[model samples]
Target: MAYPTLRDWLFSVKTFAAAMLALYIGLAFELPRPYWAMATVYIVSNPFVGATRSKALYRALGTALGAAAAVLLVPPFVESPYLFSVIVALWTGTLLYLAVSDRTARSYVFMLAAYTMPIIALPSVMNPAGVFDLAISRTEEITLGIVCASIVGSSLFPSRLAPTIIERTDAWFRDAAFYATETLSGRIAGSAISGARQRLASTINGLELLLSQLAYDHTRPDVLARAHELRGRMQLLLPIMSSLADPLIALYNSGRQSWPEGLEALLADVIKWFNEPLPAVSEGYHPDASADALRERIAAMRPPAAALASWDGALLSNALWRMKQVVDVWQDCRSLRIIITREEGSWRPHFRHWRLGGTQRFYDRGIMLFATVSAGLAVVLACSLWISSGWNDGASAVTLAAVACCFFAALDEPAPMVFRFFLATGISVLVAGVYLFAVLPHVHDFPMLVILFAAPFILVGTLIPRPQFNMATVLVAVNTATFISIQDAYDANFLTFMNANLAGLAGLLYAYLWTRVTRPFGAELAASRLLRSSWADVALTASTLPIEDPRNLAARMLDRLMQLIPRLAATDDHRHPSIESFRDLRIGFNALDLRRLTGKLGGEAPAAIAHVLDGVRTYYESCVNRRKREPVPESLMRSIDAAVARVISQGLANAAAPTATSPTSARQLRDALHALIGLRLSLFPATLTSPTPPEPETAA
Candidate 1:
């Protein structure tokens, strides 16, 4: 093998060495094994699973407290298995409940308290007099394991999460820029606009997760500050983007179809605007005449072709102006070169704020809790079954397997991860067994043992940052060291280590196979259901007739489409792939179209309602391909705007028609107008397609 490849191979298994050395020290010196398991579990699980530093602290604290509590309780009820089981179950339930009820860092404490009780307390019943000694020994082992794991993880091959966050954020900004430009241009419909809006929201969600990690870890202040600033700028952009939708749509719906020669030049100017330094506001440069003249020409444009052309011109002008402003602000901020504040008091971090009703639709909380509990139970059950079978080493073997499984399972939601855990453990056992039996007897010196132990950890730790090989090497080293330390070749310890390691491997395989069989269908089903529901919503809104109450309906449709678009993007099934893709495309188109109509109605209840209904019919026909793609070739978007303008003009004329009409007739007309406005607002809450039905009725 090449020298670099061989060096890399050795470096990747460094953590495994640390784990092995810690376990060997504890077991070889007759220290307790459970403490090592506790420490190893915490360190390995935290970094492997992407937990924040605060969470790791909570977990450590909880484990320590639970272990202490278990030491106190286990002895008093040792003779009665039934009482012990009940106490364990009740204690676990209480901790789990507390974890569920709380939303802050304290929740991790509750989770730890519940599970720690079992690991520490149950083992003491085997020998009451030796309980304290065992507990102390276990604590020592755990501390050593934690220290080793942390050193290996942080120093050897640390994975810095900040770069990933930056990359994702950049992608979000690019997508947002495209979305804003498209909305201003009025080249897409309301549904497409809504889809873009939804994508923006999703990107925000991802950013929040990254920030949470940084906060929990107490990362550099400058990084957090930059992230916060970016978030603020993005928030400001949303409202401005929303405001431009109507004007662009109106211009598109008017008669002008082609961009004017000067307007085309302006569009090119805006596209290259992001890189340019912001223009300084000079004195007496009133340059207002040119803009006024352009507006007049836009107003004089006729139907169809005129609407499209005028909209193109307006969008280009407005976007160019806004782009200049944004670029200026960006340059100013960059030039200040201000370091992000690291002090806690510098800014009130809003990362943890959960708005009212935000949690209603996020059902993953329950599933996460359930999975944790299930893992604990699976371990306990394995131990019980093995002990009942009267196999002398069965109980210990099961316990070892259970602990190993628990460590890995805690980090990942899906079952496949457990396989990695088992593989690591099994390989460690085989390698350690071979080393202890075949190589150890030949090297009696303490220096040789130290070299043997240190070499693996340093090598594996160094390579742990690599994505593919790090975990496997770390796991192998950990399991091997742990097994060799606990087991003595001349005694029963050797056989016990082998059996326990094998059991752990078996448990992992079972979990992996079971999950694959059960949850394989979830993603596909979610995609199909969301698509059907989105289509149904479109049809229902279109059917509402008299076309005067669409604002509320349009809002509702937009909400539903937001939830569905992501799911469609994630699915990989090739069955009816085009159908799903087209459905998503149509939904995107419709959302943008609806938003344009909303803008034209300008809060005129009856007119806005009528325009939405018309838009919905067109949206639906486009979905089914019933209306040819070119049906609105003359830019009917402009006609819809004109119709809206006419309705508003007529309503004003009627309101000024004076007391020529009866009081009852006037009252009825006013009530009808009021009802129309209410109906338009009501459309905003329509049910959106979701991977799962949301518990809340409204979209965030």
Candidate 2:
């Protein structure tokens, strides 16, 4: 355990102050459950000002919405507790689905609303006539806490989120750079490359979450724009670099001893450039001119149209072209970084290949539905037991169950997390018991209360910022505060306290058991689902006509890849086929390229390309049906080769009649050749064993 730094201490202090302020305000108003106000502070307080403010806003909105729901829901079904319990369970499940679907901080709203209704409504069931007042009081206390947290967090030594975002972005760039150089230099392959890529993808996924919260960070418009633009470019870089690995591996695997003339020099130069440190943030600086110089070298190395007829030339062309794209994206990333850091620059957005208007992500409705439904069932079972036993404090159990379920619904396996919550709640009960019976009895003054609370709250507050301990610390701090039920006058009823706190423990125990039974499989299940989803996506991309926007398709596929990469690391399930996500991504891109170029390629070429698409679609469909990995059939290879030969023949003819071939036609032919070659390389890298040495025309 690393010692708490100054920043962590500051966060702890600010959060504790916010909680006390909220408590004082709640006492001044004499609202029931004023400690709820204090609990809410720890629930939403983030180290960063913007995150705290954003959570405050969302928590308030969700609280009001839930309180209103309880008011509307409780009175009508108050006499029918069983029906009411069912309704509440359904509401929790349905909303939990929405919460888990969104993989961002914004998901907090739905999650809060999911459990908040139960928290408010379940307690009000015993006193139906006072439901409205109860709802109002709950909302008022929570809102009071939210207001205090937002004010204290933002006003006192606010930590800006932009610098953190910049730091994360720089770290992402470094990992990507390392992966790129390693792949380019032929130092890593197989599992090594897979591990490295997984780590990179994981970081990119994290950066996406941080970027989603950027708007709440008080970030300048230009920097925000640059950040979004850079995100798209960074996503594009994955495929570009990933695709580059294929042809490099193919070149080496084809019994080749060395790179084509100038190709080795070019690869070394590009690697060197990727490793070069970015210039310090300064005014009026630009990176494009330097990027252009390297791009020019790449352009010079491209094989002529006549040379593309051979497999070696096509592979060489694809490799060099992808390298150029990598350079372009890297340069743009650097430019965006400089501007984001300096917060001032004349640099315009340079990378526009992908026009991702807004973030597009992948969601698995099946898994989400299963997870949420299980949570709802848990709530129903808990409520049934509570109603049958006539336990008034059982409302706490049901409410905690719902809250715990919603909190962890997004995890692949939430049982262990729920178990931790169970343990944390147990700890909180013990601590709150000591404070209630032993310590708070002598605390007759508010200042004394503050001093007594300081020891535990401040200590737990530091742990809240660390990821591993975040959930448990937040629970302990928030639960302990509410469990003590601190008010204007110290009211410690031993029976009421034990019943309530124990019911909470029981609720968490139910949640853990239910989650364990429901989600027995861990990351392996999620990983399998993601891989199957990729195969389905590949099949759809291949078969679709008027092909989807390449940028949009790329974004969705890349997003899915990033999500899958981490799960792959976590699970040891070898049930998955010997397929690389990058290979799948490359295949998808190649299919889209061929679909787009079908119109541009006149003659027999379009028909041959269509055949390849049909074969790709069929193969993936079979994989989906058989529920196993299928080998790349030789027929698909024939189709791809036939398509390539036709495209090359057509292109050579066009070149023969220079006046008849427009620049656009020439470019289209080159694109078709590159896509076909990339497709073949991705599918059958090992089969192409013949090392046809590069000819002079294509070598340099």
Candidate 3:
């Protein structure tokens, strides 16, 4: 006995009111295409006031830019249709590329920039002089729709993104806790961990979107401030968690060095601490002191600087430091969970501070470049075919083709979706005809018009939130508005309506054909490419200058890893995926670790480290190529030995000289060497572990 929720009813009514008002304004102004205003209402109305406002603003701006582009570009090349089409195609391609690359709501601007040119300019190709008026009408109608949607959505039982943000934030940490538990256990299978990683990445991306949605919400200053703080804290969780894994993996692989004393006890205590209930934000979390005490005890056992050259000492010391980091992150997570949950409202004083850096994502330039070409080709082919046919309704085909290409630009498999769009267009045409002929013709007044449209608008608006139903509903709403064309004086012409509808369907068909012919890569292949590319980047990171900003590169690589994990987990053999995925990630972390430590080295150490890095790249390149595994060559092993010796000796010399500006960080240097060694062994199991430590003179 479930009933219609308040949210659904209010959202439906707001959508209906916005559409009716926009239609009234459009009819009053006598815009050339009043249907556009009506259609824009459904397109922009969202459940949240902030989301609605944000989307409407961006949509309005994008529409204006796109309209202006069509006006300026179409008239100049009108004399040459092919030249004009090509120019328009180039503009569409460039904008589409930008739209696909951006991951935020701002991308709506680029999407509009890509398709609006075709919608406006292509229809006026036969009469270039009319382009200006067409652009103005398009802009004015869209603006009217945007204004109506924003006003109605904000005023009547308006929703706030703060609540949605909080909901998502809660879900994010729940998944994060599950992921953290697995990672800290140190005995979990790769497949399980990889899947958890995928969820974490998704949560991070979700949180990011919620953070952006904050700009639109104005409900609670306390909640807003807490959310900002939570997002910054969330950023540190991934890197810190990633850092902890290296030590666990190193300990697992080291058969010669005995486990560091009290290590297992510490791990058990941390796991127990993590298992405790997360405190509510209002509860003011006080971290358990046992975890901190364990970490301090571990730190007090650090080996003397001279003892670091011992392989066992290096392994133990590094493990302890990573354990300390694990504790810090554990404490941080518990504290943040409370902060994010606490609703301080206006009572929370906002502190002005430099926010902690968040994870950065990389956009693959090469893929974007290729996408630009494909988009341009899609437009050129569709437009050229329409022009050559000289069909009276060519505008519909040209416009739909560009719309399909621009709208579905984000999908890896665009052809199937294009076909769906084609089917949806056909269905929209059918319902649109029923409404236009049977109901709209009888409507004599605006009040009657509202009644006629009420059911369709409310039902469709309710379904808009559903992922599967959204596309079809939107198409129906749009086509109904366009086809009915309810004006003061009715013009009932069947052939004109049929021609327009068929042209719309034909446009989708053109897009479908173009995509099928191109044979774009599907999700699996794209994901595979992403994994291979990440490996290449890892190898480059290992070999090249450590000066480059690695966070963005790492974030992108992790992003790809996140996407790849589910696909790999779905395959038959989960063990191999676990091994390979975690293996590569472990290697990447080690490379980053070494790169950071190398900055501390002096004398011949820099040159020696460079030699080791070159060799390290060669080992990973083999993994990237999926070639037969090889031993770390004797020469490369010798180079690593020399580099380690140089760093250890330089640190001892620095300690001996009291006047030195800086003493070499012996523990960190040893940790770096240990990470490189661990990476070497992980890459090549066939090679026997070096039996003894390199002597001081031989290393020199």
- Tens digit of per-residue lDDT, candidate 1, span 408-495: 4323234555567667666776777877677676665545665665665556555544546656755664566556653333333566
- TM-score of candidate 2 on Cα atoms, chains taken together: 0.95
Residue-wise C-alpha lDDT for candidate 2, range 1-700, written one tens digit per residue: 8999899999999999999999998998899889999999999999988788788888988888878889999989988989999999999998888888877778778888899999989998878888899889999999999999988988999998888887777788788878888889764455655566677777777876677677788998878888877777777787788678778766666545545678877888888888888887654675567678888888898888887876667888888888887887888888888878888876655455533453568887899899999999999999999999999899999999999889888899999999999999999999999999999989888988999899889999999999999999999999899889987887789988988888999999989999988899898888888888888878877895554466666668778887887786522222223236668878887887787788877878888889889999899888888876688898887777778778888788888999987999888888888888888877776644553332322211
The regions of model 1 sitting more than 4 angstroms off are 1-30, 34-56, 76-115, 128-133, 144-210, 213-361, 369-384, 392-413, 454-459, 468-471, 486-493, 513-700
What pairs collide in candidate 3? 281-338
Clashes of each: 56, 0, 1
Predicted candidate 3 versus true structure: per-residue lDDT over 1-700, tens digit per residue:
2344667777878888988899888888887778889899888877888878878888988898999999898878888888888998899999988887877778888898789888999988878899999999889999999999999888888888777776766666666676667766664445555566656656666676556667787746665655656665554465556556555655555562477666667667666776667765556446457666866777787766677667666556656665676666556555555655554322222221112232566565666666667778888877788788989898888889889888887776788988988887787788878878887777788898888788877877777756577787777777678767766577879999999878888888988988777746767666666666767776877877543566666656666665555455433242365346555666776676677677776577778777787887887687679843344577776776677677667666766774773434645565666665555444543332333464556777
- Measured against the true structure, the TM-scores of the candidates, in listed sequence, are 0.57, 0.95, 0.85
Candidate 2 local lDDT, residue 570: 27
| lDDT, candidate 3, at 480 | 73
**lDDT ranking, best first:** 2, 3, 1
lDDT scores of the candidates, listed in order: 0.47, 0.82, 0.71
Q: Could you say which candidate leads in lDDT?
A: 2
Query: With candidate 2 superimposed using the best TM-score fit, by how many Å does residue 321's alpha carbon deviate from the native?
Result: 0.8
Q: Give candidate 1's TM-score.
A: 0.57
- lDDT (C-alpha) at residue 426 in model 3: 83
| Residue 447 miss distance in model 1 (angstroms) | 3.4
